[model samples]
Target chain A: MQPVLQWENVSFAYDGRFEINALSYVIEQGDFTLFFGPNGAGKTTLFKLAVGLLKPAIGRVVLGERPLSEWKTLEIAKYVAYLEQEAQYIFPFTVEEIVLMGRFPHTASQFWDRKEDLEVVAWAMEITGILRFAKRSIFQLSSGERRKVEIARALCQKPKILLLDEPTNFLDVRQQVELFETLERLNREERITIGVISHQLSLAKNFVKSAIFIQGGSVGSAGPPEAMLTPEKMSEFFGLNVSKVSVL
Target chain B: MNIMNASNSNVIARSPEGTTKQSQIQRLLRPQLGSRLAMTTGISPGKLVLIIVFFVAILFVTFLVSLLSGAAHVEWGTSEGQFILMQLRLPRTLLAFLVGMALSLAGAVFQALLRNPLADPHLLGVSAGGALGVVVGSGFLIAGSFVLAIPVLSLLGSLAAVMVVYRFSLRKGALSLYTLLLIGVVMNSLFISVIVLVQSLVRSDELTTVLFWLLGNLSFASYPRLFAISVIIFTAAWFLLRQARKLNILSFGESTAHSLGVPIERTKKIIFLVASLLTGIAVSMSGMIGFVGLIVPHLARLLFGSDYRKLLPTSAVLGGIVLILSDSLARVIVIPQELPVGVVTAFLGAPFFIYLLKRQEAKRVI
Candidate 1:
């Protein structure tokens, strides 16, 4: 099967400064991958490039066999949904309304939300455990709940691939596990490819099928978590002594 | 751990309790219903229609009151009263309503586009641009009525001024809110200085009309003139509301909206032009009424939340109601010699603006 996304010798610059240089990775269909790195490792930048929000200065990213740059944005949005690390709002919109925004690419007409749109939104919220808070103001939501709402919104997009950045930031330990478990189920049942940028290696290691260690704006290594994240490799890449332990 | 997860799942499974399809009367009778209902299901199509009806009803009441309470007391039963109502009060009231609709709706769009609550055409240099254009076009006025020339000139000026400020504010072809606002102020000052310099050169007779217009009010509304602007205002407002969902996405943030397939640059430009057009039209009709554009949209968001589909119409209605009431107060407060409606709205709106500013500061602190 074709890879869901492919990047070859990709480089990106911000303000004419090269932040990412000669990076490449491939995300396969229905694969769960974690992009692991320290702060400023360019994981967020990689995600943006993958989703076509940012363009590579040197090379190209292909989504579903087509270069991302060639696809129309709305068409690309239908295939890949992205969730931000932190969400902010200037207006007091409801949780339901925020979730419904995921159906934006699927909107059938001008300013109209079809019944199917509502149904998908409701299902996404329900799965994310935010359905009951559907009527509550997003402002009134706790940070953890707000993160779930963001996840629900991404899910509402019903994309083939999901990209989440720091999605577990505000979630509790159990919610963290549940979120990964949910993503695992989506990968298994819906065949939705998932890419997560995360800090909690301990929580995500079991759920992710593959892991990439990003350092100095390039992929240090990419493979199964056990194969690529050895203690020696981690210690060398992080410039700190590291150890690995089996918790279960 | 699994058991606790199960329990938390159970907690989340709780159904939406005791809130659905709240009636308008019920909302009035039960104050908490406002927050409860506004937050849920957003607003249904039927509910939006009902809200529109409710505002239209309020508009009608205000219209009657405004017609009845003007400087001269004329009985509605008599021919003289009918003439007064038709000739003076009716046109003024309609003009006020249209201006209110245009300004407030534009305000809602501007706030969403700029993602700043304080954004308004008056504050962002669009209205000043319109006023500058009006001053330049002051030579063409026929007995205090602009007919249509001022609106056309003013629309181009408003669009130009905003584009200039917007271009200056761009950091790599994207707007920085702070810079946009800063340049807007500078542009406004420049436009005002130019207006003053031009005013010094024009005839004293033309100067009086320009001065009254700069303050902004409905005192100069005429029937044919009001009708012409109304066509533009309503059409522009309809176009805006059709783009409601796009506006909603844009308000979340530019990058976020872009991820969801919003053509960010195009949408922003469209909103900027639409908002500027509306501002130009309103200013040409009623001059630069400062607070309506700044406050009415915020008021709509407060009352109806920020779903632009609902917020836009709600702001339009509430704006009309607020302006009609303000104009009525303007007419009656000083008796025979009416105060400009702008004065009345500013007196009412400035404190509210400050309160919102303080609240925003408090939010930042927290």
Candidate 2:
């Protein structure tokens, strides 16, 4: 499969601190990839670079074959949808309303949402199991429901590749299982490329096909999950004893 | 559980009465095209349109009621009474409505643009700058056109303040909210000090007019002044309305808005300038009406959901209603001794605002 997203010699730093230097990686089409790393490992930064939210100081991030700099931000949004970790808001927009916002890149010029836009939004909500609460205020939903709402929103964008930063962060075990199951179905059935930043080592191993291990600021390893997430590798990178952890 | 029920049989469609007996899969596959705004807000477009029209009708009725009732009793049968109705009360009433609309709309836009719930028109210090312009401009001859000089000078002053804030608060191409608000507070005090210095320098006779204007008096509103302010205010409002969707996305936060393809800095700057223009015109016309700009948007948000598309128009109409009623009360409450409308708004808005906050809390909507 062709690489859907590629970062070549990418380097970025915030105020000359917290740097990611000479980091190169690729997310191929139809790949269910896990961005596995510890805290402050620059996984989120790499996701931002992939979505073109932040430009690299040294090198280029390419979407398909074109450099991200060549694509307009709005045009980039059409192909790559991003969901930041912890989507917080003070407003009381309904679930459907929040989901419908995903179509903004397509519907920005129109005065109102067209029929197809509404259909896509409905379909997204349905698949994400948020259809019933479509008219409910997002503020009223639990964290799991809210995550599903946001996922429905990203799905509504009909993006070729969806990038989520720590989507399972606040979800419980059952909800986590449900979320992973849904993601697995989407990857296998819809064939949308997926890149998730996660620390749920055992649970994510079941859903992810390929795992990209990031340590410090660069890729420590990248391959199938079984090879990459070995006991020795987990102990080495995450500093966690493999025997102490209990799996559900 | 709710999702299961929805996907099973009771597929929610356009309206309750119109839910066709279609499978959930088919329904999701081809949803009907209806009012998109209604689809989001759960209020149909026709009903939403009617709600806006009803509020406007209420505003017109309040306008007529205000025109008829004031401190001076007028006999409808007499030509003198008709003259007072047509000339003085009409213009003042209309000015109050327009100023209210300008302030409220500006407040709503400012809140959205700053992404701060507490942001108001005066938070930018534009009003203080306008006050300074009125005080200093009053002293100039300006080809003996004192009337034209005041509004123009105030407009220039507010724009100057905006330019200074815009220039200083921008850090590395993006506007910093903390810096913008900090500069605003500093400029407000700075302008107030200059106004006091100018006030001491002016003759005693001119001092009273400037002081009364500062306290928010509408006694001098005339037809020409009213016409000019209305034109500018309506145009600015239309411009802000065009930015409603982008403003809605902006409420999601700056990064999210940018990711969704909103030109963040450009949108922020354009909204800032236009909203400042509204504030400048409002201050130039009505002096510093304290609570209308700050509290009226909150009231509108409570009444209409936090959607800017609805909030903008609702705030305008509700602002008009609140100010018109307050101005009428200001005229008659003291019986020939007029309290400044600004004083009444604070007195009225505070209690009513608290009451609404309590209700929202009870509903758990906030």
Residue lDDT tens for model 1, A10-114:
999997777688998889897899998888879999989987778899999999989998998788888998887887888878888899898888782556555
**Candidate 1: tens digits of C-alpha lDDT, residues B113-170:** 8788768867778888888887877776675465446566677778778778878987
Considering only N, C-alpha and C atoms within 3 Å, which residue pairs clash in candidate 1? none
| lDDT: worst 10-residue window of model 2 chain A | A239-248
- What candidate 1 gets wrong by more than 4 Å, as runs, is A170-175, A243-248, B1-12, B15-43, B75-79, B136-153, B169-179, B193-205, B352-366
Local accuracy by lDDT, each model = 0.80, 0.81
State the lDDT at A4 in candidate 1.
89
**Positional deviation of residue B218's Cα in model 1 after best superposition, in angstroms:** 1.1
Candidate 2: docking tier: acceptable
CA shift of B3, model 2, Å: 19
Query: Relative to the unseen true structure, what is the C-alpha lDDT of residue B65 in candidate 1, on a scale of 0 to 100?
Result: 92
